[model samples]
Target: MPRLADKRRAILRGALTVFAREGYTRASIDQIAREAGVSTRTIYNHVADKSALFETVIQESAARVAEAQVEAMDRHLGGAVPDLREALVAFARDHARPTDADHFALVRQIQAEVGHIPEAALDSWQDTGPRRVQRAVEAHLARFMAEGRLRTADPHRAARHLVLLAAGEVTSRSFHGALPLPAKEVDAIVEDGVEVFLRAYAP
Candidate 1:
């Protein structure tokens, strides 16, 4: 069972690499099999087809990204801070930064193939990734509201505003992770966004 689990993980990792390198339409199961160092039969045994594999990869990758973002929120907002603005800027910086090469590549692939992928897969990605990240941020903001550190009637809306303000411009300029932004530029963007967020929400 352990060996089987390891093989499945390897296949998933390999599939992600292939899918990211070659968008879903061009990625082949044989390529994934070679990258995984497993047989095509093993790949088939785990997933029904390429579509299913793609769905699995997106779901898994999205979960990871959501987890990372939530962790960033917690790290910066989980405890008391003497300077809310600074802490928020820190969180914004971390949140906007790319998680990993594979993750970034996968994001690029999603943007490239958004029209070609199944609707269900896109929905799943949204639920697992963006929505989950937003909810996590909302929960953190709600804690601040309860503590009287921030003033927002709607935590969800505030969360969305903060996220948009922090990521909107940088992400657009980066072309959804296809282009990398310089560290100094990302810091400037996050700091500016957090400043705007504080203007509206700070207590």
Candidate 2:
């Protein structure tokens, strides 16, 4: 027999697919149950209601993405960055391209129907994902400032600047990965963004 945890995982996965396709207002428990290959009662046993299930799905997905981003930051920016601009460019390019398409699809769904989503769920998603990644970037910027690589300023603001200049640009152009961008265009965006960031922050 499948473990309860396994069933819950299946339900979450199925819910993500349905939500991404149907949005919060239209997604039905029956559809989610079918996608999950479980009974509607099984879903009820796992979660209290649709809102709770949506909250769990988004938070879990955000955490998974945040963990990967933190690891990427550690690998690219956490250690000895001999060339700051080069390192930033590399990191920006990596960050712009996420391996998980389904998660971003859900993000699009959220964006399309933001008003309908629960405020608490949005807060949890931001706390679990974007804010955590931003904090990681802020810590790295703080270290760079202490080392005299960047000008002395607010690490928080610097982190935001770097993110906006680099991956933020690419994400805007690519529509959060819904539209595929060519490697050359991506590289150009990263390079230009790093250059602009360095112009402002370089000591």
Candidate 1's C-alpha runs over 4 A off are: none
- Candidate 2's displacement at residue 7, Å, is 0.6
lDDT of each: 0.87, 0.90
Clashes of each: 0, 0
User: CA lDDT of 142 in candidate 1?
Assistant: 91
TM-score quality measure for candidate 1: 0.92
Model 2 C-alpha lDDT per residue in residues 1-203, reported as the tens digit of each score: 57998999999999999998898889999999999999999999989999999999999999999999899888999878898877888788888886778888888889899999999989999999999999999999899999999999999999998888888877877778989799898888888888999999989
lDDT of 1 at 126: 91
TM-score for predicted model 2 compared with the true structure: 0.97
Candidate 2 regions exceeding 4 Å error are: none
Return the TM-score for each candidate structure: 0.92, 0.97
